[model samples]
Target: MKTLLEAHNLSKLYGNGRSQVVALKDVSISLFPGECLALMGPSGSGKSTLLSILGLIIRPTSGCVLVQGKPVEEDERSRARLRNEFFGYIHQEFAVIENETVEKNVMIPLQYARIKPSRQERQSRILQLLKQLNLDWAVHKNVSFLSGGERQRVAIARAIINHPSVILADEPTAALDRKSAEEIMGFVLSMRDQGCSVLIATHDERIAKTCDRVLHLVDGRLL
Candidate 1:
C-alpha cells in the first residue's frame, strides 16, 4: 500500500532550556489507505502531541511530515489548506458548534473547501451521512440538544463531509458507554474499509483490539 502520511524523526518541545518540556522526541510512523492504526499510551505520553502534528494542528519543533511522500513544512497558509483538504479530525471533545444545525455543521468543511456545492447537494450528503452514522434525527436540530455520543457522531459526519483521505481521532471513545463505543468504532472501521486511512489516539483496550495495528508511544518515543 502507498503511504498516505509519514512522520520523519519528528520531535516537539515547549518552552526552552530548564523550563522546556519535551512533548515528543523522535517519533515516526507511516499510514496507508485501508488501514486503521490505534495509538496507545498513558497520559502525557505524547500520543496526542504526535496526533496533533500528523493532523497538521501543530507544527513540530523538528523533523517533517510528508503527505503522499512529499515533505510538508510549517507553512501556515499551505498547511492550513492541506489540513482542510486532506485531513479530518474527530476531537475528544467532539467540537461541534452548539447553535448550528447538524446540516449546517456538516456543510462547514465543504464550504471551507470553496466547492460552492448547491444546497441540494449539501443536503443530500448530510442526510446520507446522518443515516450512515445513525444520526438522521439530528439533521435539522441544534447540536446542543443532542447527547454526547450524538454530538460525537455529528462531529464525525462533519469531519468526513469532504471525504478526506485521512481521519485523525483523539480519544474518540473516551466518553461513551460500551455499546455506543462499539457502534462508533464500527463506523470508524467502515471508513477504513472505504479507503480512508485512520489514526486513533486512545487508551481504550477495546479500541486497541479493534485496530488493524497498534502504535505504542512511551515517553515521547514509539515503542
Candidate 2:
C-alpha cells in the first residue's frame, strides 16, 4: 500500500491582478500503486490542469509533488529527467506526429529514451500494444490517415512504451464510442492490476465507474 504519487497543497494561478484566476486551490491527492483513480468533474473543473501538474507538464504555483515518496526538485533538468523516466501521459489530444507512420509515432518515446531495441523487438512491442488497444490493423498506416481513436491508441502506446510507474491521462476516452471507451477503461484497469498507478481526468460516467476511487473536483478544490 505504498504511495506512488502525492500532491500537497498544490495550486496553479493564471493571469495576474484583475485578470488573475486560480486554476487549482490548495488541492491535494495521494495515489497508491495498483490503484486506478478517476478525477471527475464538469467543464472548467481543473481536472486536466491537475493531470498536467501530476504529469510534470506544468509546475504548481506553490506546494510540493512527490513520486514514489521522493520529493521532486524545481530544477528544470531534474524535472525533465524524472518525467522521462517515471511517468506516462496520454493527453486529450492525440499529440502524435501526423506525418509519421503509426509505428514510428509509437516508437518516438523509446528512441528519445535512447533505448536501442532491435527492429524486430520494436515492431513486436508496437504490435502487442496495437493489439491490446484494438489498433493492430493500423500498425503500418500513416498517423494522419487514422481516426481519432486510432491516434489516441497510438499516443497511449507511446506513453506506455517505457512501462512508467505512473500514468496520467486527460480525457483519454473522449474520442471513442461507448464500446471502445469500455475497452480502453478495461485496459487502464489492467494497468492498475499490474501495479502501475493510473490517474485519469474524465467526465465520462461510464468510465468513472471502472475506477477504484472517484475524486470529485469542484471549482479548484477536491469536493
Candidate 3:
C-alpha cells in the first residue's frame, strides 16, 4: 500500500531543565492506505502525543510530518487546512460540545472543511452519517443527555463527516459495551476498506490484535 502519512524522528518535550518531561523520544511511524495500525501502551506512554502530531493538531518538538510523500509545513494555517481537509479524530473523551444538539455537533467540522458544503448539503450529509452510526433519531438531543455509547457514536459520526483520508482514533471503544464496540470497529474497518487509513491508539490487547500491525510504546519510547 502507498504511504499516506509519516512521522520521522519525532520527539515531544515539555518544560526545561530538571522539570523537563518527555512525551515521545525519537519516535517514527507511518500510516498506509487501507490499513488499521494499532498504537498500544500504558497510560502516559506518549500514545496521544504521537497521534496528535500525526493528526496535525500540534507540532513535534523535533521531527517532521509528511503526507503523500511531501513534507507538511508546521505553520498553523497550513496545518489547520490539512487537518480540516484530511484528518478525522475520534477522541477518547467524545469531544463534542456537551450543550450542543447532535445535529449541531456533527456539523462543526464542515465549517472548516476545505470543500465547505452548503447548509442544506451539510444537513443531508450529517443525516446520512447519523443514520449509518445509528444516531438519526437522536439528532435533536443534546450531547450531555446521551449515554456514553451514544456519545461515542456521535463522536465517530463527527469524525467521518468530512470524509477524511486518515482517521486518528484515541481509545475509540473505551466507552462501549461489547456489541457497540464491535459495531464501531466494524464501521472503522469498513472505512479502511474504502481506502482510508485508520491509526488507533488503544490499550486493549484484543483491540490491538485486530489491526494489521501494532506498535508498542513504553515510557516515551517505541518498543
Candidate 4:
C-alpha cells in the first residue's frame, strides 16, 4: 500500500553555537493508511518535534516532509492549507482554548476547512461528535471547567472533526489516569481501524504495544 506520510532525513535544530539544541537528527519514517504507529522516547528526545514537522506546524531545519509522495512546500499559507486538509494534530498540552466553549473549540478547525459548512451544518456535526464522545452535556461549557479527561476528550473531538487522513498525537495520555488513557486510546484505535494513519508519541509501554508498529528515538536519532 502507498505511504500516507513520509519524513525523509528530517532534522531540527534550535538556537545557535553553544546554545544549540538538536531536536531531531537524520530521522526518517513513514506512515501508512489504516495503521497505528507509536513513537517511544524519553522526554526531549524529539518525538514532539518530529510530530510538529509532520503536521506542518513547524519546518525542519533540514530534510523534508511529503504527503502522498509529494514534497510539502514550506510556505505558511500552503502549509496551513495542507494541515487543514490532511492532518489532525493532538497536542500534549490538550491545546484547547480554556476560555472557549467546547462547541466553539471543536468548531475552530471547521472554520478553516476547505469546504466551509453552513452554520447549521457545523453545529449539527459538532453536536453529533460531542455526543459520540459522551461530551454533549458540556458542549456549551467553557473548557476550563472540565476535568482532565473531559478536556482530553474535547481535544480529541476537535482533532477529528476535520476527518483528517493522518492523526499526530503528542503525549496524548500523559496527563490522564489509566482508565481515561485507555478511553482516549480506544478512540485513536477506532480512527486507525477506519483507515486514518495514526502516529502517537508516548512513554506508555502498554500504549506502544497496542500499535501495529513501534519506533524508538534517543538523543534525537531513531534507534
- lDDT (CA) per prediction: 0.89, 0.86, 0.90, 0.93
lDDT of 3 by residue, 1-223 (tens): 6699998999999999999999999998988888899999999999999999999888889989999879997588998988977999999888889999999999999988767899999999999999988889999999999988889889988888888999999998887888888888888878986778999999999888789999999999998
Clash pairs for candidate 3: none
Off by over 4 Å in 3: none
Give the alpha carbon lDDT tens digit for every residue of 1-223 in model 2: 7798999999999999999999999999999888889999999989988988988889999988998898988888788877877898987877899998998998876675645778798889889988888888988889999877777778888888878889999998887877767776677678876668899999988778888899999999999
For lDDT, the strongest prediction is: 4
lDDT of 4 by residue, 38-73 (tens): 999999899989999999998999999989999998
Candidate 2 TM-score over all chains jointly: 0.93
lDDT of 1 by residue, 82-195 (tens): 888899999888888999998888889878775668889888988988999989987999999998889889989989988899999999889888887888888987897678
* RMSD to true structure for each model, in Å: 1.1, 1.6, 1.1, 0.8
List the pairs of residues colliding in candidate 1.
none
Alpha-carbon runs more than 4 Å astray in model 4: none
Best by TM-score: 4
For model 4 the local lDDT of residue 204 reads: 92
TM-score of each: 0.96, 0.93, 0.96, 0.98
Residue 202 shift from truth in candidate 4, angstroms: 0.4
Candidate 1 weakest ten by summed lDDT:
110-119
